[model samples]
Target: MSDSSDGIAGIPHPNPLRRLTLDQLRRRTSVKWREYPEDVLPLWVAEMDVTLAEPVVRAVTDALALGDTGYPHGTGYAEALSGFAHRRWGWDGLAVARTKAVPDVMTGIVELMRLLTGPGDAVVVNSPVYPPFYPFLGDLDRRVVEAPLGPEGRLDLDAIEDAFHRETAGGRRTALLLCNPQNPTGTVHTAEELTAVAALADRYGARVVADEIHAPLTAPDATFVPYLSVPGGENGFSLMSASKGWNLAGLKAALAIAGPAAAADLARLPGEVVDGPSHLCVIAHTTALREGVDWLDALLAGLDENRRLLTKLLAERLPAVRYRPSQATYLAWLDCRDLGLGDDPAAAFLERGRVALNGGLPFGTGGAGHVRLNLATSPEILTEAVDRMATG
Candidate 1:
């Protein structure tokens, strides 16, 4: 609203973060746009409001132009992601030999769970987590065990070990589905924490399945340690994708990297599991990871500004809505308990302010009275969404 140009709410972002205006974003039929009415701003989902990186767009369009639409071949996605990890996070342990292409991160998780656990077995998850962890693991007939985060939303190592002990008791096979740079809360687990987890999993004999889709979006102030790079982490599985960083979600491609000791299990995956991967997705995701560094950097900068901007906005207009600007990803976990809006503040925001945010209740455990806000949008839109929440 200020049009001050120097910054918005003290977050310096002179470059236009998103190329599209609300009118343009509204024209799309994606879930983020179509989920709510025209008047409502949907900042709930992880979808970015920005356009695709230039290389990704070029790769897709070039493939279409050549009429090269067909099933994917080779381990290009694996190689691409391995290279990305080495360059992006200084993790050089990934080899194409230990990677596999899956339809997406969720698909990879299910397949990995199948390899590690059986039906009716237990799977440990950090609470106030990504909602799909419940249904996805449930579909596998695996039991869901909670290891809720600590009071400050950081990993509760004691709670994790306690859950691992409970779940693995009596030789019951189980897996730990970890969210590094965790979802909703966006607390990037320190390398020390991750190493502790790896050791605990080893001691308890439970496999670790890390869903690190948000690995690349970590803020400059934070460090993202690739699980496999740590000692004892060699037994875990890390799933990653360019879908979040490059806005390639519609293109279905994801990679599951196995540590040295877990390669055999990944190799045991059924062949048919690879059927859902799209060739176009592989090309786009690969191109983005391999060549879209500039665009990705710009996007991260914008996201950094948006995260800071939201902090200032809440402090000024809606101080009651407790928020912590995320260190990774574009999500802001807002503690709305002080608003006295009950367990599901999202509903009230939708009904009253016409702003749609992710409901905290579904995240389970600590989720009640919390809402996860997406900050991957234009500054004006972010301002409008928060303003709507204040009034709503």
Candidate 2:
């Protein structure tokens, strides 16, 4: 609750969660469904098919109106970000001083991947992860030590521990990039699970870069325990954004927080890496934290409703498609091994049903026989998608 810069409030960071009304979402030009003519439901990308809060749009518009689209100063944006973290996660020790403005979560990830380990070194990621995790590590010439997640998309602690030890024993420095409220599966790691991961990473001297962008979107029943808070925790980094929850991804706002230990490592790296798109993101993020809570709560309720609706309809209509219930995010990881779509059901879904969901195989080596559906759309569209896939 301390200020990081002059004139910044010592406390009261903005709350960044909000939901858009149906009519409001319908009106937004950025809404994907409004632009596409294919009639193919866009449940593929993670962007919400909804309008942003009016305040965000206005702030961005005002910025453009003023004709000062210059790059943003970093310190000016810390206050709202600090408040957002505090309000969303009850993170008490989080101060404005620790947060860094970034262009997007993926850019932060790539930078952290470079900062933590050298190319040809290994970085650990649990499957089926967000597909980009692979390229983020691989593009840097780093190896991906894939630890397959357990049934129901649970993180297999034993496999993770084994991977950590094997890499360390081989004289390689490895880092674990965890997706909290994991995409595709929408699994929010439990406290005990996170504690276990922290212990293993600590033992191996590995860093855990927890991607918590989806953490704010978790269902009411689920709890998101930040990875670094556990015992034996070493260097930890948390990457987040209002883009995921508030559907302002196109505005390009994201945050990355590195603890004291990790900050030391970062100090040795180039300064520009931390100085991401601090300006534009700052406006949307500030608006989201200050005035977006009501909309976010409504969004969670809608996503929860959609989750239930999809589950029920899948059980009743598409008996062969097994959709494991999720604790966070609108994406549902499905077992279509029974669907007879052969190895890739995502391709089959698109070709046969005109649905453009993400193919699961790219998530990891273990992701074959699976597909991920984004249920963050209207019930009517969801129903139609189900019927299209099932009837075939």
Candidate 3:
């Protein structure tokens, strides 16, 4: 089959990929839809509004039909990602022998961080990042050092170097948690920027752990360079999955890849950690990696269309609200500082516009005058959302 969200141009469904409808979607139980009352339009969560890729549904359904559920097994999870990396990102060094299956991306990230740091240690992160990064690391007794992003939304290397130096000043080893195609901002890190980061990490003796879960949702034309694929990255760890890309968070399966030098650290992880991934989740993600490419292409197309629609809707309706089209993922970071919505723009939007959005304050430092809007929905809903914000 060719790369398409639907195998064919047109198909029958309660929610066809290209033409998503909220009427058909509110029937579900995802947090995005269920978090608020019917009167409130939900646009806060990272998941999409499109129907599941046909292949993913089939894989999970067939497993349940045959009662194939059990403890996770085999190297299929790693092998699937390896093959996907080769075909999708053109990186082929993913050896199944060097890979391990984790229950989810966040779980894998914390575990890898443990291998590099201990209690009271620090981790350098670009501010206004994924909200969970703070608490997740905090749960492990790790402190976070902010290396705030520049106004243009790109990596601030000087700030990163300063933070890295400060973290290591205590003679304590730290880990650099990188969110490639950075969350909230959707700024795809250039190969040059990443290489410089790697060099900096090497100089400071800090380990690098990249949460690359959003790598698959990258736009068709925007190049996504895998963190471990660049120089000085041979020892960095990469966390990836089909969960975010395919909207399979409930399945809970992810892969953790180690660069050649870091492969030995894989042995440091407790064997019981492998018990995290559900057996069926493995089957679903493996199927997505191997067979869900076409469906993914279609989803990307849908997101691209929604992002463009948001751009026009903002320009015409709420010109005061500044939004930069994301280079990757369906999440849009809005610079609402100009909207006169006070320190917390999201609160104003929810109270006046009846729309739900992620508050920027919780994301740290640079997030004070911003809000995160999920664009993974039908254009009809998107246009209405903008209009509500405009008239409110």
> Between the candidate structures 1 and 2, which one is better when assessed by TM-score?
1
Cand. 1 Cα-lDDT: 0.87
Clashing pairs in 2: 13-83, 14-289, 15-289, 16-288, 16-289, 17-292, 18-295, 18-296, 19-295, 19-296
- The residue-by-residue lDDT of candidate 1 on 289-353, one tens digit each, is 88777677778888888888998999998999888788898899999899999999999999999
Query: Which whole-number lDDT from 0 to 100 does residue 85 have in model 1?
Result: 85
Best lDDT goes to which candidate? 1
- Which residue pairs in model 1 clash with each other? none
User: Taking the tens digit of each residue's C-alpha lDDT, what string does model 2 give over 1-392?
Assistant: 32222112444322222234445554555555554445465577787755456567777889889975887775645676567667777766455566677778898888878878887888899988899888767888989998889865789999999899988886678999898978878899987898889889988988889898887788988887777565544478888777787777777867777776676654554567666575767787777766666667667877887888898899888898887778998788888998788888888887777777777789986678988888877777778888887764
RMSD of 2: 5.1
> How do all models score by TM-score?
0.95, 0.89, 0.96
Worst 10 residues of 2 by lDDT: 1-10
lDDT score of residue 392 within candidate 3: 76
C-alpha local distance difference test of each model: 0.87, 0.75, 0.86
